[model samples]
Target: METEQLYREHRSMLIGLAYRMLGSAADAEDIVQDTFIAFAQVSEENVRSAKSYLCKMVANRCIDKLRGSASKRETYIGPWLPEPVITDDGGSLEGDPLSRYVHKESLSTAYLLLLQQLTWTERAVFLLREVLDFEYDEIAEVVGKSSVNCRQIFRRAKRGIGEAPLATPSLQGKTMELVQRFAEAMQSGSVPKLLEVLAADAVMRNDGGGKILAATKPILGADRIIRFFMGIQAKSEGAYSFAFTEVNGLSGIVTLKNGRPHGVMSFEVRDDQIVNLFYVVNPEKLTLLQADRIRPIA
Candidate 1:
């Protein structure tokens, strides 16, 4: 098959892999495009399996990018969060079942944060084996490690992430109901209502990237978080509007101001309570949402 054909067939999958590995859709697309360019230069006869070959190329590029960005993140402003990517049916990956599963599990903000705790090689190995379902030997070939070593690396990555599996799928209706109620409570500045939905030890982390006003550190505990939201409501009474939407495969909200994109928030629910909230308000990170004119609350 021609290189272009190979690219067309595997582009979404490659982008998904890179995005999960690097947690930046923009950087992931660049890496995938570069990989295809490099693939075009290689002799077709030299390739054994096009999918495997392309996967290896994208994996290596992502690892390199991650290694280079480590220092930058150290110096980054505020609480750094993964760049949000729209995972709605037509947004990021293709609509196939496996692709949907991968997007829902691996591309989530929570999982991506856990991935950051892994070393570059361990991240690559873990994703290749667990997320992509590559055989051990295939992973060994892609990451340039022996099969035994790859297993070890995978194990270490799991341990690094506390061996916690991806969150089980939640009831969509219930999750959306919770999100809507939470948004209403915040808008109304109802502390009791907010506390009713939030986990006792709930945590809120905002990523402003120093471009806007945001907490320099995570806001912990439900009471503290409720107070923080109340303060925000007091200061910006009519400045922002929110719409319910699905982000990273879970119910979420998008904040807007005067009809322009402001921020996106994704939540983690456990036992019907909001355990974690990720607010990505950095202007640079909302570019894609603005470009798409994300649906507003009706």
Candidate 2:
């Protein structure tokens, strides 16, 4: 297949992989684009299993990105968070594994922040093994480590993120109804009502990626979480705005200030209550949420 044709076929899935691995849609697009450019430069014959080759290409690029250290993050503006992406297509979560798994994976904004607590290697290993369900050997190859090494990384990564507490297998129909209710409460300025929709031990985590003023640690429990949310609203002085967005195939909150979006918040739901709240305020990752790409996809 022509490179462009192959690219179109796998672009969405490739972006999905990079987004999960890097936690930024923009970054994923950049990484995938770079991979394709490199592939185009090669003079290879018709390749069997184009999808696998494409995956390998994207994986290698992600690894390269992990290796090259970037400059220091800026002085934070406020609570740094991960960039958010649209994962859901306004459809029921009853399709492909990747599309249906964010809620169950507990990959809401909060979980992504917990991810920040880990080193890049740790994060990569955990994403591949736990989130993507890659075999130890496959993850080992992707991460350029021995299977045993990948296993150890997964164990530590799990411990670091063990605070994700919630039970699932609930219908998306039911969970989405509750998400809508929670968004309504926030919009209507019903702090108490909003708190009522949260889990008893609900946790809030914002990832500004050290470039913005964000909670340095996870804010736990209903009371603390409520106080934090209320405090933010008070500081905004009613200028803050929000919307319910479809992110990563899960329903999430997109928060803005002065009509410009600053963060994307998503949920971890159990039964009918939101168990964890995730907010991504990190500008670097926020590129994933952009409505326009610098260069439109081919």
CA lDDT of every candidate: 0.79, 0.67
Q: Candidate 1 lDDT, tens digit per residue, 32-131?
A: 8899999999897888788888999999888788778789889999899988865554454344332353454545578789998888889888888888
What is the lDDT, from 0 to 100, of the residue 217 in candidate 2?
81
Tens digits of lDDT, candidate 2, 139-256: 7666668999889889999999896643233434555677678767777778788778988888787777776767878888978887777788887654777666665545666777
TM-score per prediction, in order, is: 0.90, 0.70
Q: Top model by lDDT, which number? A: 1
- Error of model 2, residue 277, in angstroms: 0.8
lDDT of 2 at 144: 68
Q: Lowest summed lDDT over 10 consecutive residues: which window, candidate 1?
A: 92-101
Off by over 4 Å in 1: 90-106, 163-167, 171-174, 290-293
Question: TM-score for model 1?
Answer: 0.90
Give per-residue lDDT, candidate 1, residue 81: 92
Q: Write out the backbone clash pairs for model 1.
A: none
Prediction 2 TM-score vs. true: 0.70
Best by TM-score: 1
